[model samples]
Target: MSSIGTGYDLGLFFSPDGRLFQAEYAYKAVENGSTCIGIKCQDGVILALEKIVISKLLKPRANPRIGSVGRHIGIATTGFIPDGKHIVKRARDEANSWRDNYGSAVPGPVMADRLGNYVQLFTCYSSVRPFGVMSFVAAYDDLGPHLYMIEPNGVYWGYNGISAGKGRQIARNELEKLDFSTLKMKDAVKEAARIIYATHDEEHNKEHEIEMTWVGEETNGIHTAVPDDLLQEAEAYARRTVEGGEDEDVPMNE
Candidate 1:
């Protein structure tokens, strides 16, 4: 018989049932489930998450997966990707239905609120049980980027910026230096990668995966940056200030 532990509040979501949580769970493997950061820039909101992916049942790695659940809103995730995909699929389908009926994309903030509600429901019934998952949902609306933590029980809170997976402490340390309110989309993406790269272990041979989506007044649509381009930009930004290749502090003046 499989012994599932009691419900734990490690953050991603609360589990009503107790079960044996893995090391990743002990560390609250749920990325943004613990802390999130958000910056409302002049152009729009920039939301970022730690690049680590961890769980008791999963291996350690960097998985940057983000998407637009609605036409105008985007979500950046830092947790069990399968669950994130599950949530995204449902959200996207619902958004599409709304668009078909309304003839326009649903607003970003509204999409986030709806998604958050769904997460809450998921947590209530699923978090503490086996095969539970945690997630970070970063969204944008008229205001800017809004960050949140979604548990298996279906509860989530809107936050600014957050880190998940492994080495988030290192990521958070880097995030502390930024003035989020003035950040622009371009600079925000660069900084997001810079922080993650800084915290990642170079000894490990793994694909440096990252995905960024921008939505706001200028480009209120979702656009995925090429990994190579993003790396080049991130390196250049770091070179400006640091003695190394780039400074990583290039401000978005726009």
Candidate 2:
């Protein structure tokens, strides 16, 4: 007998039936958290998240939901901010080390691979529990834009559109309707907002309750500021979509 203490105390690797119960438990933590969305388009990638503040006092203290992991890579998460921060810091350190040694920005997929390995280690060790965060990593590499979803189990893959945290399926459904081949950055932004607004209820879908960022060929680093004009457009789109209007057409750039 492995002497399972509380049934939930069976370590991260295996449960009573050889199931990775701890990983599922971590995912449950994610399903109870805020929503984060990522959409990869021809131009680049966009990240949007709902800001769920514990209290009004911490509204300003909560900060933005996205972080820069490298010169061209950024990340967003939907659970355990501290865990996300720690993992991001580790990613930064890894990127910095790779740059110092190889004189290059770590490739987006390479960074994801390294982080996945790091997360996998925790799942195998009883001393530390798996991170309760599900993250989206956005990068503009030589191969163009890439989006990745990484879970507590260290599973990661490039994605066209993805959502993490509560109501993720709703968000993914919205993304599924998008044609990645023809999507532009602006259209992607509105879609990102729409995903969050749609996933969350009216109480949590207010404008101020949303935080968003994007990166692309024209935009460098993480973009936290959405122009007032653009934000209003996104809101209108979300509103119309909710009111059962037709989806907007993809913008064709010359």
Please provide, for model 2 over 182-242, each residue's C-alpha lDDT reduced to its tens digit, 9 standing for 90 to 100: 9888888788877777887666444346677778865854434555567667867776787
RMSD of each: 6.8, 3.2
lDDT, residue 243, model 2: 71
Clashes of 2: 0
Model 2: per-residue Cα lDDT at residue 15: 56
Tens-digit lDDT string for candidate 1 (149-241): 555545566545556556667766776777766766677766765665565565764434344555565465443332456556664564454
Candidate 1 lDDT (Cα, whole model)? 0.54
Candidate 2 lDDT score at position 240: 77
What CA RMSD would candidate 2 show?
Answer: 3.2
Question: For candidate 2, what is the TM-score?
Answer: 0.87
Model 2 spans > 4 angstroms off: 1-5, 58-62, 203-208, 220-225, 244-254
